[model samples]
Structures are given as structure tokens and as C-alpha cells.
Target: MASSSAPSSAASTAETFPAGTPAAAQIFTTVLSQGPLTRLELARRAGLSAAAVTKAVRPLIEAGYLVEDADTEARPALGRPANLVRVDGGRALFLGLKLTGDQVFGVLTDLRCRTLLARHAPLSDRVPKAVLASTAEMVRELLTEADGYGVRVVGLGIAVSGDVDRAEGVVRYSPFLEWREVPLAELATAVTGLPATVDNDVRALTVAEQWFGAGVGLSDFAVVTVGAGVGCGLVVHGEVVAGAHGVAGEIGHVTVDPNGPPCHCGNRGCVEAIAADPAILARIREAGGAEADSIDEAVALARAGDAHAREAYSRAGEAIGRGIATVANLLGPERVVISGEGLAAYDLFADQIRSAFAAAAFGSAARCELETRPLPFEEWARGAAATAIQSFITEPNRP
Candidate 1:
């Protein structure tokens, strides 16, 4: 018997973005990020003439990718001088998933990267096949949610930790997942029947920050993540720097202590060894003799006036600070945004972090602004979705 409602299916006819001309995509992106502008302002911002902006906007407006409304308040007495134009965020949909050791997080977002709904599924296994199965299931659930918006889901993005080759759509190596050389994009496309984009989780999040969050309008900035892992994402000249080998920003691997502790990467006293959650937990257990099974327990112990626990966090903070100083010295970014799961304990050692950074930073590098933000876990998923939107705009669809 039929129930009160019907079930939603994952089957979707992937649609192509209608903006074919370079100028059209450029104009659409301008509206997507900084929009509701008159043709004059849009032309100025997009570096095009009024005639060119009008030419590029016609197709997008006809295809529903853009909408124009008369500025009733700003109207001149002569005629509808210049109307305001903006993107229709509800025009399309996407799915972004982030893979962790124990969980797979998924988010459904609109064309403008707005998170409409989110879902979490347990990753019981780390094998490529198992992870793919879990990912496909999550995608199906998100697709069902997308049915509510009555839009076709056009693209999929998967963000993984460790070395990922976005152009090649392969995860070269993921330490946490124990995955190596996984052709993630091809396999995922086969499973879910949507064009897929694969990227490093941190780099993908850096893209989101550059466009919609902290890094907006800054051509030079760095994103440092702490907690489960210490990762850095760099942006220079209005683009995320992925390095020649696609492993550019491995700040956590910087050697801070020559003889402090051994790292999983076979290095001694790498920043991650001292600052990552596992490292801090180990320090609390071994040196402090505290039975702190997780970072939360360690944080609680420190807050409860445990000197040993406090010392562990301080050491982690010092390592992180030194790492940031290295980034500043090398690239001279204007701002550094520090985030990640580890920041939940910022109050424990914020002073130590700032002190170490100040002492190590050199010359004008010391003037760089350090901003601390704690993004909700779901934002990572949205970042993955943003990458899909990026691929849609920059590159054509692939099976």
C-alpha cells in the first residue's frame, strides 16, 4: 500500500551548466560571490565593458542562472537606468562528502554553496571498497533530500586527508584512511552516476574560506588546522597554492624538536607529533600519567588544574606557533586563520601559542594577523561541495 508520502530516488540526469562563454561564467561567478550589482558595477568588478556584460548576462538570465530586478529605490527619472543582477542560488544542487577514519560526512548544497541539509554515516571499514559503499549510501540519502528542492544534483565532491591529486582525481596517500593510490573520482562516479571531484580536505576548505569566509578578499593568507592533524593551506596571488607536486603545505611535518618525539612519518619532533590530538593524548598518558583516552579528557584534566595536562597543551601550542612562524617567514601572508578540532582547547594554551609565534616570526612577517575560528564540522562537507562547484565552472563535466 502507498504511504502518506513517496520515497525519493538517487537517479538524476546530470545537467550541464548553461554558461558556455568564459565571460558568462565570469559574470555569473561575480554575481555568485559579490552580486546584486548594477550592470555598471558588474562590468567594473568583472573587468568587462557594459556591452560585454550585457552580452554575457543574456544567456545566464534566460537560463535562470541569473535574475534581474529593477532597483525601484535607485531608479532614475529618465528610465530603468541600471537594474541589479544576482545569481539564483536555488537553480542547481551539489553533494560534498568528507571522509574521516571513523565517519563519512555529507552535505547537500545549492549552487551558491549554501548547506541545505547534512548527514553523517559511520565508516565501519577503511578499505577502498567499503568506503566507497558507505559513500554511495550517503550520497543516496543526500539525493533523497535534494528531491525536496526539485533540482537535479549535478556534481559530487569528495574531500580526503593526506596527499590527494585533484587534477588526477586520485588519493595518492591517506595516512588516516590507510588508502593509497585510490582512483576515487572514477569509482565514485560509477557508484553514484554523477561527475565527481576529489581534493584534499584542507585545500578544499581553503577554497571555501577564500570565497565565502575568512580569506575573502585577501590574495595572501594561510589556513592552519590543528587537532586530529596539523595541516596548513596557503593562498597566494588570489589562488590556492597546491605546489608543483600537490603537497605544498605540510606545515605539521616541520621539525620543531630534533629529539623530542618520533612521528608516524618517521621524523623526529614534527609539529604534528607535538600538537595533533593523538600526540597530546599520548603526552598526557605517558608523561603526565593521566588516563586521558581522548582530547576532551585531557582538556578537562588541564582545566581542573592538572599541571601535567597543562604542560602537554603548552608544548602542543608551542609547536603550532613555530609552524605558523615558518609559513609567515616563507610566504609572508597577510593573515593566518587558525582552526580545526583541536582548537576546542584554545584557552588552555593560547598564551603559549602567541608567545612562541611572536618570538619566532621575523621582521614584517610578525605583523601578520592571526585569526582564530572554529568551523562547525559540517562546513568541511560544504567545502567539498564548493570544490564541485569550482570544477563545474572551471572544467567541463567528466564521467
Candidate 2:
């Protein structure tokens, strides 16, 4: 069996993960997501015998990946109390990046998804060449910072806002980045000399949520991100759903009105047509409430109680709500998490979203909880890191 101990190489510092064995991986994953578990409880949850649990944990414990905490008060009346096992966050490191139209946001995180440092730089050019250059610079900067930790950077994950083929490490298409069929993993590896994984930003965020945030322990949930372009990530049966074509949960393009507005996708009245940042800005401009140059200006106007700006946001909310309802009705997710830059205007649209969702949902679908989580750009980068961590553990031999 592969040892759970991490490699000592400065470029691959993550725990060895012992993922070759299904039981070891399952036990570690359980603890990583819902840990501080007693040996007996772990055995029960993992559907393994007490002996198997002990056998699996020993290597992890020896590697400093899993730590045992004594529980004196929990001592059983008949026998010794079981100690709890938990992941040691500081033992490994990973890097993540979120590639936007005009900027690349990056972060270095420990195994626990905690951000250690963040860096951002503008993309003066959007072409693949320019973007790759910027990404290499940012990765170099983060790698320098990692040097101080005395741990290797195990993986690099890049999240873009578009159709991403994670398994193939390809960017099928990214509207914002104007990229098509970019072999990002190969390019990134050549530049940074680190293993790379690419994924849709929202899907990457879903991974982070699955492992460390709101969706933890939930088998089915949806993460709806509203910003530059509306995005959704679906988790079904305890796994992130990447459709056969690498596109799933695309709530942004869900048509809300055939006569609404023209979307860049050559469609009429897409949810994105009415609610994305550009659409919101265009509506505010047409309404003549403010001389807004961007979404920020429009948000400022709404915050100042401009009726036209408020109405625009309300309309966006309604469209978003309708789209979310579609997701809930079709998938019946346990929860729908709303996030992204647009949450800055959440107060303006929260009511409309709730009301529209209530009106459109069918029966118990309305009971699907709607939650708002305000996460910074670094969180997206952390999501990328989570993907890298996943690949490192599950497909170490992937090239």
C-alpha cells in the first residue's frame, strides 16, 4: 500500500494521500469533510470494521496528516473511549488562480483551504499569449512566497469563466477571455513546472464548498454565482456534476423571456441577457437614471435609492430567481447558495429574488433554501486550489 506520508520534494509537498486504496481515501475524505470523528463513528460512517479504520488511520497518523485528540470525558463505561481524528491543515500547500477577462487573481492555501496569501494583476491583453504570461508571473510570485514555508507547492489550479473540460485540462471556450480550445494545463505546466488542473470558476468554487464551506456534508446542492457572467455549479450524489460534454448547471443561459434582450450567445432573453453585469449596466443606461460607466456606478446609484437603478436590479433579481427556480425544480437540490460580485447589490434584489422564486417554484421545491454567501476573489482561487488538491489525491499519475 502507498504510504500516507507526503513527498519531501519542494515542488510536491502534499501528503502522499494513500488514495490508491478506496477505503483509505474514503476515510480521509470523510474526516476532511466531517472530521473529529471517533474511531467507532468513522468505522460506522465509512462502512468499515474497527480494525480497518485503525489500519487505515495508522499511516495517516504517522505522516502527520491526521492528528488524534484524546477525549477523556467520553470514556465508555465498559471500555476505553475512542479518540477523534482530524486533518492537519499545515502539512501541505496548494496554489489556485481565477482568470478573468482583465485580471488574474491568485492565492496560496494550506490543505484546509485557508488562504495564506493573495495577489492580483491586470491583463493588459486578453489573448492566450498575454494571459499565459500574466498567469506565469503571478504563479512565480506566489511560488516565491511559498519558499518561506519550507513546503513544496503540490499543484496549481486555474479557474476560468467558461466551458472547461477538467478531465482533459482544456478550456473548451471562455467568452470573457475570448479563448477557445486552449490547452491550459499543458501550457501552465510548461511555464510553472507544477502539475496543473483547469476548471470552471463556479465549479471550482463548488469543490471548495463541498470540502470546506456551506455545502459540506450535503449530497446535493447548487452554487449560483452572479457577476461578470452568471454561473452555476451543481453537486449531485455527493459529486460535482460535469455533464458528458463538460457543461452542466448553466443557469446563466436559461431563457427567461423570448422577447427580453439579445444575449452574446445569440439567444433572446437569457437570464444572463437581463441579469449579468453588462446587462444591468445597459439597462441602467437606457433608464437614464445615472451616467453610469460600469456596474459599479449602477450599484452606487441603486444604493443611493435611484428608482430606475433599483428597478433594473429588481428585474435582474426576478430573472435570476426564475433561473434558480428552474434549477431547484429540475434537481431538487437541498440548498442553493448565491454568491459572487453581484451580491454587492443583493439588498436591492433580495426581495425580488425571494418573491419570484416563491411564485415560480412548485410545491416543496420552494422549500429549497436560498442562501447568500459573500466571498472575495481569493475564494475562487482557493476553489482552484481545491481542484488541484483533488487531482493530486485522485489522479497522481495524470499528465
Candidate 3:
């Protein structure tokens, strides 16, 4: 299910995106990402003719997607002030959901992918049916919230981990959820009464990072997330690499140690096998049965100088560092943004990660900037909203 499926009879009547030329979308995106610019600057950044930018901006402005304001600073240089065009963030709203093993994170965002409100619910089960039921309830609540803003909720985006075929809206397989060939977008749309996009969770976050966060203005970058799972998302040549098979930048499965540990993907010595939360816990238990019921307790144990707990985190950090090295060597991205839940224990293994990454990185690839940005689960949901905004503007007729 890589393509949008037609809504069933139970679907709600959703509004359609405004019609515009292809350049209109690009022009709007340029403004959306690096906006509030003069037409000349917009054209320069978007690689379009000034006339083309003007032509594209008109329809978007009329449709309320773009708005122009006089540039007060440009007035003195010119007899008339130049107008700056930008995305009108309040024109529409979107819904984004990040589904995790134990929780469902939901957020409402506007055109700029700013979170208006967020909600989370515990998941008692990971079955497709249960997930859909929870998602529908969250969507309904967000829709009610959208009423106060008086803008249509344009689309919905759901982010899940593992092999997801975004073009088909299918989950080829998700080990976290134990899902197989699930037509998630179709089912999600049916339940929520809106067009839906299903994507790999990390890739969804990469979208947010690319447009609104650390990745802005960079043509090539990578996002490596560590937590329950080690996941990677890459942008090369200004486009997210989904690979020909919709699987790419899977640094978690990168073989850091051939003799390490068993991965959930049935591979040995994979980075995720050693660095993910479960893997760390297993390693901790193996040493002294510290009996840590949660990551927090495990963190506390390590902070308190428990050699066993500290060693578990050190190994996990080394694995993560090597994984980051692999990405740098292979792609030479401008930067690597490290985030996710695991950063909570950053102090425990920050040195190990940096040292391992530095020792393993090949030559100038070592110059690749590595930075950590602690992100809450709500931000991941906002990433989902970014994908929904993307679909709304670019694939309005997806179904």
C-alpha cells in the first residue's frame, strides 16, 4: 500500500488543497523553509526566475498559503519597499502521530508544523486493530481542538518504526509492533476520516529536522536516533533517500561487531543489538542482575557508579559511535543530528561515543559535525505533522 487508497463511505468530507502550478509548490516550500524573503531572494534560493516566483506566489497568496509583507528595511535603499513572501502558518492545521511500543504520541500542528497541542496515551497492545482504535480517538480529539482555530485539518501523518513503504502506505514489517504487510495509511484514513500518510518514524522526524530544525539550509545531513531502537534517516542532494526499496540509512543494522550480540532483526553484532534500550538492559542483567525495571532506574544505577550498569552503557555508546562513523564514512554528510530517548543517559557514555566515533571515522569524514539534540516524544509527533503538511502541499491528489 504505497499509494493513497480511496476513502470508504464512512470517511469524513475533507477539504482539498488549493490548485497551483508545480512551481507554486516549490516556491511555497522555499518560503516555508527559508521564508519572509524578497522575491529576488526567493528566486535565488528556489532556483527559479523572479517572474516565476511572482507567478507562483500569487496563487498561494490568494489561497492563504503565502502572505507578503512590506520590507521596512528595504524602503531606504529603494523608493518603494520590497515585499517579503512567507508561509501563512495559520492557514491550515494537520494531525501527526508517533506510534511507539508502549505509547501513542499525538500532536496538532499548523502549516509551519508548530505543535498547537499534544496528547499521549498508553498502549496496552500493539496489534493493528488496537493501534487504529487509539489513533481514531486521538484524531477526534484533535479535530475538536482544530475547531477553535477555524482552519481545516488538511491531512494526517502516522510514523512507525521498521520497514515502511511510504509510497504505498504499507508497513512491510515493523518488528516493534510485530506488524506485517499492514495497509496502515488506508486503515488510518478510514478510522480518522482524512487522508493519511504512513512513514518510517525516523524519516518522518528527518522531515521535520530538514525543514524546521538543525537540518535547515543543509543539502546533505543525517539524523541518528537512539532509544528503544537505533534508527537513522538521511538526506542526500536535498532529498530524503528512501532507497529504491524504501529502506535506506539503516545504520542501526550496521555491523559494528561481528561477535557482538543478537539483534531483533536476527543479525549478530548489529549496532542496535548492543545499543538499544532492551540490549542495554540485557547486558546489564547479564553482569549483575541489577533488576532495573526502566531506563530511568538503569540510568540511576550507572550514575551511582555501579560498574555493571556503567559498562552496559559504555558498550552501548561504543556501538552507537561506530554506527555514526559508518554513516559518516559512507555519505560524508555535513552534519549528524543525534537525538531520541536514549540521550537521557548521555552523560553516562558521551565520551565513549565521541571517542569510538573519532577512532572509527575515515579521514576527513571525521570532520562531519556530530551534535546531540535532546528531543521529547512530542517533537516526533510534530515530525509526523511535517510529513502531513508535505503531503497536503505536494500530493494533494494522492488518492
Q: Write the per-residue lDDT of candidate 2 for residues 82-129, one digit (tens) a residue.
A: 788999888888899999889899999987778999999999899988
- In model 3, what is the error at residue 192, expressed in angstroms? 1.3
The residue-level lDDT of candidate 3 at 376 comes to 93
Residue pairs with backbone overlap in model 3: 1-168, 1-169, 2-167, 2-168, 2-169, 3-167, 3-168
lDDT of 1 by residue, 1-399 (tens): 122112245335456777777787778777777778889999998889999999989988898889999888886879656689988888889899999998999999998898999999899899998898888888878888788788878888899999999999999999999999999998888788788899999999998888778987688999999989999999998789999999998999999999989999999999999999999989888884668987889999999988889999999999999999999999999999999888899999789889999999999999999999898668888889989988887665444
Total backbone collisions, model 1: 0
Error of 2 at 167 (Å): 0.4
Which number leads on TM-score? 3
Reference-based lDDT, each prediction: 0.87, 0.88, 0.88
At residue 175, candidate 3 shows an lDDT of 87
What TM-score, over all chains together, does every model reach? 0.93, 0.94, 0.95
After superposition, the stretches of candidate 3 with alpha carbons farther than 4 Å from their true spots are 1-14
How many clashes in each candidate? 0, 0, 7
Model 3 agreement with the true structure over 1-399: per-residue lDDT tens digits: 222233323223466666467787877777888888999999999899989888888877887888889988768664788888888898888889999887899998988998999999988799998888878877877787777887778789999999999999999999889999999999987777788999999999999999999998999999999999999999998898899998899988999999988887788999999999988888998887578988888999999998999999999999999999999999999999999999999999899999999999999999999989999989999998999888888886666
- State the TM-score for model 2: 0.94
Score candidate 2 by lDDT.
Answer: 0.88
lDDT of candidate model 3 versus the reference: 0.88
